[model samples]
Target: MQTSPQAIFFDVNETLLDLQPVKESVAAALGGSKELVPLWFTTLLQYSLVSTVGGRYADFGSIATAALQMVARQQGMEFSEAAAKAAVKPVRSLPPHPEVPAALERLNAAGFLLYTLTNSAADALEDQMTHSGLKGYFAGRLSVDGVQKFKPHRDVYTWAAEQVGADPKDCLLVAAHGWDVAGAGWAGMQTAFIARPGQVTYPLADAPDHTFPDLDRLADALTMR
Candidate 1:
């Protein structure tokens, strides 16, 4: 079995926080078609990478709004920038997954330094943490905006490790996204994949050091470790 990590960095969206509210908002903007919600989110992630690869930086909120507009175009609907922005606004107030608070408490009490590493801007991350009531459990928050690159990027993972003053190998990146886990692994950090519903590891990527159905299970395993 592997030893415990010195610190843990969490991915914010769809990992600690539920994305249902934001997906509902996006669905409303897309004429009540829930199916289009995933398209918008995937488009947002795609364009974020485009921004990074092209050496340009745009805040995630702006990218979300733009991606919503793109989805509207795909469906032959006209979407106003203001309307799209409104749809993406609920992201700032998403609720934490039911098990997140208790799990975080367990991790914190176990003496692991907990921090958030996310693509959201600093202010946005603050709003999310405060709104979700998960703020007090964390010791700090790190945002990719600080380095103008999004997660799954090598620089972003390495940068976050440095921010926590931990060697990459000593840090554990706990994320619901397979891509995030893969990136952290590629960056030389330990990884725990929180297999949130519908999320799976990429077949070609190295397996995560730990895989659990939820954070509660992860906490149980970690404390035992």
Candidate 2:
């Protein structure tokens, strides 16, 4: 049986914040068609995985830019340095999902220590959190920039746990991505899957300890458990 968390670590992008604006922005920058949104996102994840396997590391933004260029080339679209940079502008200003603030407030009131772990840069994380009025709720924000590895990597979770001075088993990782949840589970942390629509779960090597339709449900489950 999983122990209740002493600290809950959340994934930034789709878990608590909506990335639709970022998707729309990128689509506009790519000539006003939203068709390439999935391609761009997939490319971003691909490069991050490749870099880790090849023992190389790039910041998320750098990888994002490179991936955009690659996707543009495949679509026979001309890539402009300016447009590529603009495509990522939304990352710095994404709004939190509707339930994020309320759920986070409830968690805080319930006395659960909270932290964020993301593939984004520390500054990017800070900007989003501050913009969403959630800066005060987090005890800390952790970025994978230093390690250059992405989710499903044991080292990143290990590093995050160490940074917060918590045992891996004592942390509950709440994320919308199955890979993030799998990674945390493999690292020995209990996992909660915030099942945002259009995302799917896989029969990965490690699986989440719990799954909920949204943050509000997750909060209620945590309270009950």
Best by lDDT: 1
Tell me how far the alpha carbon of residue 108 in candidate 2 is from the true structure, in angstroms, after superposition.
0.3
lDDT of 1 at 44: 97
- After superposing all C-alphas onto the true structure, candidate 2 shows an RMSD in angstroms of 1.3
What count of clashes does model 1 give?
A: 0
The RMSD of every model to the true structure, in order and in angstroms, is 0.9, 1.3
Candidate 2 regions exceeding 4 Å error are none
Error of 2 at 33 (Å): 2.8
Q: For residues 1-225, write the lDDT of model 1, one tens digit per residue.
A: 155787799999999999999999999888999999888989999999999999999999999999999999999999799999999999999999999999999989999899999999889999999999999998988899889999889999889888888889999999999999999999999999999988999989999998999999989988887
TM-score result, candidate 2: 0.95
Model 2 agreement with the true structure over 94-196: per-residue lDDT tens digits: 8899998999989888888999999988778888888878889999888887567887699999988898898999989999988888888889898898899
TM-score of candidate 1 on Cα atoms, chains taken together: 0.98
What alpha-carbon RMSD in Å does predicted model 1 have with respect to the real structure? 0.9
Compared with the true structure, the alpha-carbon lDDT of candidate 2 equals: 0.86
